[model samples]
Target: MSSAKVWTIAETSGRRLKPVSYELPARGRMLADKLGTRLASVVIGDQVDRNDLQELFWRGVDEIYLVTHPELAGFLVENYSNVLIALIKTYRPEIIIAAATTTGRTLMPHVAVRLPAGLTADCTELDIEEETGNLLQTRPAIGGNILATIKTPHHRPQMATVRPKSTKPLPRDESRSGLIHIVKFNPNWIDGRVKKVGMRQIEETGAGIQDTDVVIAGGKGLKKGENFSLLRELAMLLGGVVGASREAVDRGWISYPHQVGLSGKTVTPKLYLAAGISGAIQHLAGMKTAEVIVAVNSDPEAPIFKVADFGIVGDLFTVLPAFISRLKGGKAK
Candidate 1:
């Protein structure tokens, strides 16, 4: 082996690269530079666009490991893990990072066990320790009330899954250059135990909260599940999606997909409207990165006001209808 390098697993949907694929290299490049190592990205799919793969180099990766085969079209944990394990054994990277999406949450643990390496999941932050060169993984712990930093000092490959949208991708630099190495697929690596039959696509009302430019989120102060309808209406008027704090989701006011917090999806919308939320640290962790934060709470001392670009001190029931009325071209009392 020449030297230990940093690796980022590229995530793809169909033949297109996911946004997090670029985000990984942006972050990985920083860590690699800190460790005085090279940054590489592993891309696996069938007939994936070469142009999409090349963008990784523009983002920051110094090397690309491309694995393409008909059998690899659909992601099977067994097949993907086998391929990754084989590559790891050969390259022996010092660090590996993947997005904490569905594929990553499922695949990383399986690969970690097979490689017998320590793994961290849903990390909010990653850093390189100066003296030890350990990958520092930070995540919310104890019900998202506190943050914990972990390190795999004894492991060969420091593995971590980072939450999507936790950080921004680096600006593309067309001047950057890298080499792509084609990795051969092994037929025997495919296991008969698991097979992909089909994939189902669920119909959603509008764009996902994560993808929307505006987000209207409610919390425990909304009082009941029915009250979430007000949020839905406001979201509709704003051409956005409705999101819920953990408390509202816990109360069954909305589905988990609409949740925004440390335990849920991280959103970086252009405008985030929080209603009846006290702004716990966990909830803030997810939406604080929004360009503009507007909070509405009855309590003048609510923590949400601390981060809000605009704050309103009033009962949500009274305040919401006024907003709805104004947006509808009706005069507000």
Candidate 2:
């Protein structure tokens, strides 16, 4: 008998799978390794992208369950919850891991209520207690005053929604193979409540939030709102996005859409270039998961460099313009 199975939601955008799907399998490995059981992933959508799924196998998922239905194309809270609740009744996993994202934040609570299980939201870390085989759900509490460690002692499947960029992604190993199970999905079962409403994909001006590989983030070091244009130029030159520190947003230097921190959005872009940013703890809480972090700050002792994979000591005004000019093949460094 399987000791425990892990369930994860696979988010899809216009038939393309989102990157968060890869995160759960890596997280499942962490749980299964401790529990000594299998880590399973469930994909719910109208169709499955076989090519995008190859990465899941490489990341150490034991089983992948695919649920397809016409009404499941977009995010339908009722349909998703019902289908997932049914799966939980059937498999009875010891733990269910979901991303602490917009859709997930809305969906997991409903499922938890239906199953009557304890749910942990925005968990920064997940681990299994070696002796008890229990899931340890850790998250910040009381306005970041305390770090709370919680467990679902009586619940069968302890559910948790983890923040993106909170954990390291496992490297892909192509040699490892896994099992794939296709679950039967009936369109009529969910055709009533779930309707495919108007779908419009909002495109970011300079960067696509979903697929940006590199990001150049700015902080209060900028003197005025006009300074963001420099960050944008550098980002465009590097084929990256322009991110903003919470301070910059609060100061009206940039819009909240570009702000990144605990209160803002979480990003796991490959390379994060932080300029003129002091790197507050709240800001660090968000983008700490970048594969390679490069900090460029005038203050030689800024905290941003602490988590940076690479650090550059300089002034953003002088540094960025020079970098852009060099990239544009105009002037010498």
The per-residue C-alpha lDDT of model 2 at residue 121 equals: 91
Query: For model 2, how many clashes?
Result: 0
Candidate 1 ranges with C-alpha deviation above 4 Å: 1-4, 205-214, 220-240, 246-253, 261-272, 278-293, 299-310, 317-333
lDDT top scorer: 1
- Please, what is the whole-model Cα lDDT of each candidate in the order they appear? 0.86, 0.79
Which segments of model 2 are wrong by more than 4 Å?
1-4, 142-145, 165-169, 186-196, 203-213, 237-239, 250-253, 267-272, 277-314, 325-333
TM-score of 2: 0.80
Summarize candidate 2's per-residue lDDT along 1-333 as a digit string, tens digits: 434477666677756677787876788887887777877777888766787667778877777777877667777788888888878887788888987777788888998988899999988788888778889989876545578999999987789988654555579888977777777775544737546668554444422432477888999898788998998888888888889898999998877778788887667778899999899888887677677899999998899989998888988888888778999995665
Clashing pairs in 1: none
Q: Mind giving the per-residue lDDT tens digits that candidate 1 earns over 53-169?
A: 889899998898888888888678898899999999999999999987779888899999998998998787899888998999998766455789999999879899886665677
